[model samples]
Target chain A: MQAILQLLVSGVLLGGVYALGALGLNLIFGVAKVVNFAHGEFLMLGMFAAYWLMTLTGINPYLGAPIIGAAFFLVGLAFYAGLMRFTIYKPELTQVFATLGLSILLQNAALVAWSADYRTIQIMPAGWESIQVLGAYVPTNRLVAFLYAVAILLAVLVFLRSTFIGRAIEAVSQDLVAARLMGIDPDRVFLMTFGLGIAITGVAGGVLMPSFYAFPSVGSFFVLVAFVVVVLGGLGSIAGTILGGLLLGLVETGIGYVAPDLKEATHFVLLILLLAVRPHGLLGVKGAEKETLK
Target chain B: MIEIRDLHAGYGDTEVLQGIDLDVRAGEVVAIVGANGVGKTTLLRTIAGLIAPSRGSITAEGEAIGGLGAHRVVERGIVMVPEGRRLFPRMTVRRNLEIGAYAARARPRLKQSLEEVYALFPILREREDQLGGTLSGGQQQMCAIGRGLMALPSVLMLDEVSLGLAPIAVKRVYEAVRAIRDRGLTLIIVEQNVGQALKVADRAYVIQGGRVVLSGTGRELTNNEDVRRAYLGLTEHA
Candidate 1:
């Protein structure tokens, strides 16, 4: 029983990072209706940014999260202004192809600059401290990361609910034409939203560095997980992504204990099953199909 | 205050609006009536700047606004309530209204505009907390109109406000139209319900195959034999 409880705790902690990663992707997709193929690259770039900052300046990764986040936000804005603007109003195929091309370009660019060797931040304190809860040991870094995730999620939720610009994002997500008629420049909203989305990944990368390794292709692995979480959580629903992340974490962890080799297979199988059962996802709004299309 | 002369517009190769000419005077309510594929909605969309015109000029207050984007046209004080009552389904009624005031020019008077919109549709104020998607068709139409009014526009254009609504709901929408017109805003309405549109409009135009086949005072268009036979289905009675 203690073993089961330990697995559950660990799963929940991992789920927090997954949730954070999925949140930004879902927000950008929801509002802009563009599936950012380069989303994973942003995560990859963020982790590298934090890693380099810590190595060069000796700034703690945790303390440098906001700085990295701000830098990524600016980078995201430039990415949108430079490449995304031309294809935003075009056909869906154009958007998909353009972003996919960007993803390829970014991956190669990282390879040329940083090389393919895996690297992990070697913090002095080493973050492996654990706490005993209900006879289960939990890592302190995991706990801190979970708390950080929750805080960011809450802040994002409040931003969406309380601010004028946030409401415009929601509005554009629902109906682009209607939003435009309301005097929102969809281009400007898209640029800001894309920046905000990528910036969250930056913060998530900073939080994750102590617990995970960094590599040129590290983002590719987790980006798949994030996509799974986003779809399982119901495309554009923020709260749904959080729940989906948790559910996926638990499922993956539980299955890994039973059959470690089949853990990845189990995740994909469960995703397919859930989609077949509920096309719109568990918490998705009915008739919200339009949110998925541009 | 709005004029379109020799306008041509389309989606890709096929033209949806061809050589359309019309004028709407200040404080006048103009209605355009036509069949489903006759480009009634496209005409309104062109004027609202959703689709750029291929040729010709659209001038509001004697300034050319033919090819401006929808957001720019909105900044110029033209607003549209698109067909099918397009509301932000997941957003609360209040948020929808707040977004309606997104234009910089409308931001200063947002409070006054909100009050006016609430006055025009008191039910919106009552259901402000409800999700927009949950509203009934009639209520959604009301919300769409209310959202347009929130912009405090100089020219308000509504496309198919009466579509998919019951007769009583149609009456309520027309009443709102009359109230809007009474406020001295230039209004352009595209509707399939010929009788209801003519009842409130100052002038009417009949579009067919993307061309203005006929146009006159609302009463004159109502009495015209061709319009009556084609649009109003009055030939059977005649």
Candidate 2:
């Protein structure tokens, strides 16, 4: 019974981190209607950014997440203005290829800039590394990341519900042509969505850096986890991302308890099963995936 | 007041509108009636700046707004409630209406405009919390119109509003049209239902092959032989 409880606690914490990482991808997809293939690469850069900020400025990553978020927001805007603008309205294939190219470019850039060495930050003091809760041990790093995830999820929900620009993003996602008729410039909405989405993803990466290793190919692993979380949760759904993340986390952890070697394989396996069975996801509207790129 | 002269527009290499000329006075309810694919909707789209005019000019309140995009044209008070009642399907009815005030000019008057829209369509107020896609066709039309009104546009263009609605729904929609006309706002409507459109319009143009084949008061077009035969399905002898 204690073993089961331990797995559950670890799963929930890991799920929160996954939710944070995928929220940015979902937000960008929801509004911009483009699957940003470079999403994982952006997260990779975020981890590197966090590492450098701490190395150079002596400010810890937990303290520097907002700064990283703000800087990545500009990178997102430049990404939209410089590259995404041209392919946004084009065929879905064009967007897919464009982002895929960006992903490869960013990965190779990371490889050259930092090498393939795995890096992890040590922030927890000697005795405070893990905490016991209900007889289950929880890593302090995972707990902190989970709190950040919860806070951000609430913030995103409020932003969508109460703000003008957030509602405009929602408006554009539903109908691009109609949004235009409502006097919304699709370009401006796209730019803001990308910025905000990347900002969140950057924060998530910075928050997760302590618990996970930072490497060039780290994005590949995270990208799969994030995509599965998004697909399981619901396309374009913020709250659904949380649910999906938790479910995937529990499933992967439960499976890992039985076979540790196959834990990494669950993301791919579950994504395929979910796609074949319910592509619309738990909260997504039907046919949303089919129409986004067209 | 708005005017379009020798306007030509179409989707990439396929010209749908060919040198169309139109005039709409303030507080006038003008109907542009024609068959499907006859460029009636295209004309409204061009005037609303959804499409650029390949040739000719559009002037609204004496300002030349020939090639300005829809976002810019909206600041000048031209708004469109596109066909199919293109409400943000996932957004609540209230949120959809609020989005109508997205234009810079409409933002300041959001509260008053919301009141006006609610007063115009009480059902929208009732369905305020519901997602737009869940509404019935007639209700969606009302929601779409309410959203357009939220923009506080001087000239409101409705394209194919009566397309998929039932007869009673169409009548209710026209009643709202009458009320809007009485409120002294310019209305440019493109409706497939020729009989219903002509009854509500002050003046109308019968478009054919992208040009205004006939223009007259509502009653005159309703009585004209060509318009009667072509649009109303009536012959001189039948």
Candidate 2 runs further than 4 Å off: none
TM-score of chain B alone in model 1: 0.97
In terms of docking quality, model 1 is: high
**Tens digits of per-residue lDDT for model 1 on B139-181?**
9999999899888899999999999999899889889899888
- The C-alpha local distance difference test score for the whole of candidate 1 amounts to 0.86
Instruction: Give the C-alpha miss distance for residue A109 in model 2, angstroms.
Output: 1.3
Per-residue CA lDDT of model 2 for B1-238, tens digit only, reads 8989999999999999999999999999999999989999999899988899999999998999988998899989999999999999888999999999999899999989998999999999999999999999999999999999989899999999888999899889989988998999899999888988999899999899999989999999998998888898888876
Query: What DockQ does each prediction reach against the true complex?
Result: 0.82, 0.88
Which regions of candidate 1 deviate over 4 angstroms? A124-128, A285-294, B235-238
For A51-81, candidate 1 gives per-residue lDDT tens digits of 8999999997778888988998998798889
Against the hidden reference, what TM-scores do the models get? 0.95, 0.98
Candidate 2 chain A: 10-residue stretch with minimal lDDT: A285-294
